[model samples]
Target: MATTPDTPVAKALRRELLLVTGMSGAGRSTVGNALEDLGWYVVDNLPPQMLRPLVDLSRHTGDSIPRVAAVVDIRGGRLFADVQAALESLRDTDDTRLLFLDATDAVLVRRFENVRRPHPLQGDGTLLDGISAERARMAELRSQADIVIDTSELNIHQLATLVQEQFAEEDEPTTRVTVLSFGYKYGLPSDADHVADCRFLPNPFWVPELKELTGLDDVVADYVLGLPGAGEFIDGYVAALRPVFDGYGRENKRHATIALGCTGGKHRSVAIAEELGRRLSALPGIAVSVKHRDLGRE
Candidate 1:
């Protein structure tokens, strides 16, 4: 048998092959859209067995499809098991990466309810029942994932921004940070790697004038940041996170979520998160964005 030398198309295929899989309602579509926006050739609901054929076809197309992302899920039923084997085989010849999207059971349930659709695995049982079964089946894959994003607290735009941050052109920063402001009453963000409580600062909600304004307003922002220990806490927290950020770089973690919580997300937490974001953005080699998860929930 004659051995064929590697060609340009084969070299290109070996550079980028991403397998996107996760919870049914965890925003795989959003991820696909974002990846497309960033120049990825996306294939939706592709069965595992078809992956190799797709790559082979892409090779024929040359550089037109430089990067390829395939969205795979449990919807394939029994064939889902083949995904693991396919992934293992690709690892030998490709720079394969698996990205897993996840959210809490509560969030998934709410999303399913909003869409008025039954879980693929629900059968005759409740939504939670299906969620439980799916999670059990996906346990191994999740553990094997190179990147895992928890979308429990993310809105559509926030999730899209995350995908863009992770998949955008190579010139961007290596690590992107999301500084999230959320209300304690609304529950902590499940995806947050670090959380800070802003309750120690005075509640602006009680201040009649500031109550009407959000942290985006200078008056509210000044009030929150002027409190004793406020500036010091932000500075200290940033300093403390320096090593954490360094570690993330060393470990090749591309994204990190830092959540700040107060009684309500409208005032204290939002102000703090903004200031933190501003400060972090100034640091070299890091990109930061701020989001108020419960800003209008009042």
Candidate 2:
């Protein structure tokens, strides 16, 4: 049935379309649930061609289903190619937005292994091969996304919290920066956007009394922050990030990871990461969180 343009249902459904997509193990399912928690009508694995009709269904269903979010990914195989054409119909309007979720290759592989499932496109090849194929195919979609989240270090709860933070309010999405602390021996955090070393500070491990203590302890933190040049580095690094944040804004990147490393994550790096987190949190429109990636590994 053709409905009048002014119908209450049609008017209620005039909001933007939110398309959730990304890597196979990149938490698309979690994001969909997060959207549902935010009161959105979420559809999973929706075929690209049915997108417009889905909207029409909402438009004709009265105000019961005003906002809609769809999770589309590689599971649709060849049909995924039609997504470009499907998106073209919505491009003329400002009502279409895409949210892309991604994680480092290592993280994605780990996720798949943890679930004991093969990659959707893996076939008879190695896990890496399937991941490579999926990334290549999804490249264009990723580039077109309005929001890109790197989930390399996030747990499901954290990811859900982040999704809620971005979509909970209509005002504006807040940029979140994660300051991660790690030990050099453990290798760099694969997802870090910025990295700084705190090894210049003398190791507290040699200072018998502080050996067993971590940066969270007041004494360990005080010792690290009181060292020569510690305060200077923190100030300068925070200052330098201003231009970086500006660049991110221009590029519309809402998430960033900064890694600080030391000989061991137990002391200096952890202390520095906390300081950086505190400083970065004070910045306007930006939220900051700190994590000690290798804190207790020793």
Candidate 3:
């Protein structure tokens, strides 16, 4: 009863496989570095066609490399075009998951400009044009991604932190929750699965004493939480989310983004988001992290 290389039993020997891909400037390197720090065997610029062989190698190595992560991108040219088929080939083998890194076109362009290098697909066209073309090419893969991280507003440290949160350990939680605080004036967070508005609470911006302080400050957090109905909202929201979290767990959804917004994103939203993150973190089998998207934009 020898199982073939492509058989389910053979694939099950490799416990974890992460295929990291996405836009050129969307922090793939950061993800790879973070995964490496977590003791994952990370292979950079791996062609899609090699995915199965990589998994087989990991299985062959036994306990030497329990987790394997491959970084695949447009740099492989036509070889990259085989990703979807490669992914399908690995569907039943191991805990294979795809992590797609993304950022807005403007942000991608800015990143490329900062590095003073043209996009791989840029050719003679502008940076924005290259980004657009890449996006178009990645559209299908993005749609099939198990997790899509938008790094438009995230700094390098923040992006690294996110990667660590998602894949820091082998015994990580089943679901990872990110409580993001943003500003309504800055447009909604594109990756938010659920959004709550803290504008109904008093505006801390008008309070001269707390105007400059962020939600991370004890004084500002106290002021924001002291408002009427603030506590009720937090409690009710957490209670309502109990079933939602259960549903997500049952559906095998590993990530959820809860975005909280206020007028300026400096005070109310940030405070509420922190409180919500605190409460959500207490839920069993859930990993929570908070990000103040527009904390210092003003």
Candidate 4:
């Protein structure tokens, strides 16, 4: 959505405006892509002061652009020094929300190194110094955010998927659940809202015939599910999670991540997570999907 010469800026309150901001190297680009995929009109690197024009354009365009997500960084060639003033200028004009995406300094530095680009705030100092400046500049945005996602543990694809799940418009209010399976040796999934360990069950890697198969295979899945505590654990965990989902829906929080870890992600964790997803999907007003994070890492 953009304001054209014919559109009046005073009548821009008809459109919903979402301002996406955060520390540099966080995941604004990915989040913008996800929102665009879900049918939102996305504008990138837009200065906060330019929001009125965009909203004006959307307002005059009728319902063609019901939603507009603008990626606004404080360092985008212009400093939004007073986050409050920047936000208040538009809040009374439209339904505005600020989304802040963040990660640890270590993660931001690693990302910059991987992309082989200089940080926007980086000048003569080291990468850490640049991250420190960016974090400090973004502190106000975080404080005023309507939503915040810590991307410290999220990969590009994972971040995109989560954004899509979190912002998609549903026919009715519903909760979205992601069941992620990973190997304990690879460390935990820091983005997970809840985590469960599956190491108590016997390892299918010990069975010669099942060693090469993954949990997606019928035999391997059956073998893992047939274990002593598997069914009981799955049943109890699903029961315990139902109330959590309901509570999230009540609070207007739409997305959740539940991680399962075992010795290796190939068998036990994958099978159990898939089963849990299946059960959760069967409930009313809940959508579930599964991801095997370390399934093929061997």
- RMSD over all Cα atoms, model 1: 13.1
Which candidate ranks first by lDDT, i.e. highest? 3
Candidate 2 residues 61-116, lDDT tens each? 87787678988888988888899888878766537788999998999999999999
How many pairs in model 4 have backbone atoms within 3 A of each other, for residues 3 or more apart or on separate chains, i.e. clashes? 0
Model 1: pairs clashing at backbone N, Cα or C within 3 Å:
none
RMSDs, each prediction? Answer: 13.1, 13.1, 13.6, 12.1
Deviation (Å) of 148 in candidate 3:
0.3
Candidates ranked by lDDT, best first? 3, 1, 2, 4
Q: Distance from true position, residue 37, model 1, in Å?
A: 0.7
Clashes of 1: 0
- lDDT digits (tens) for residues 18-99 of candidate 3: 9999999999998898787567899999999888888888878978898999999999999999999999889788699999
What is the C-alpha local distance difference test score of each model?
Answer: 0.89, 0.87, 0.89, 0.85
Per-residue error (Å), model 3, residue 193: 40
Off by over 4 Å in 3: 1-14, 170-298
Ranking by TM-score: 1, 3, 2, 4
The TM-score of predicted model 2 comes to 0.53
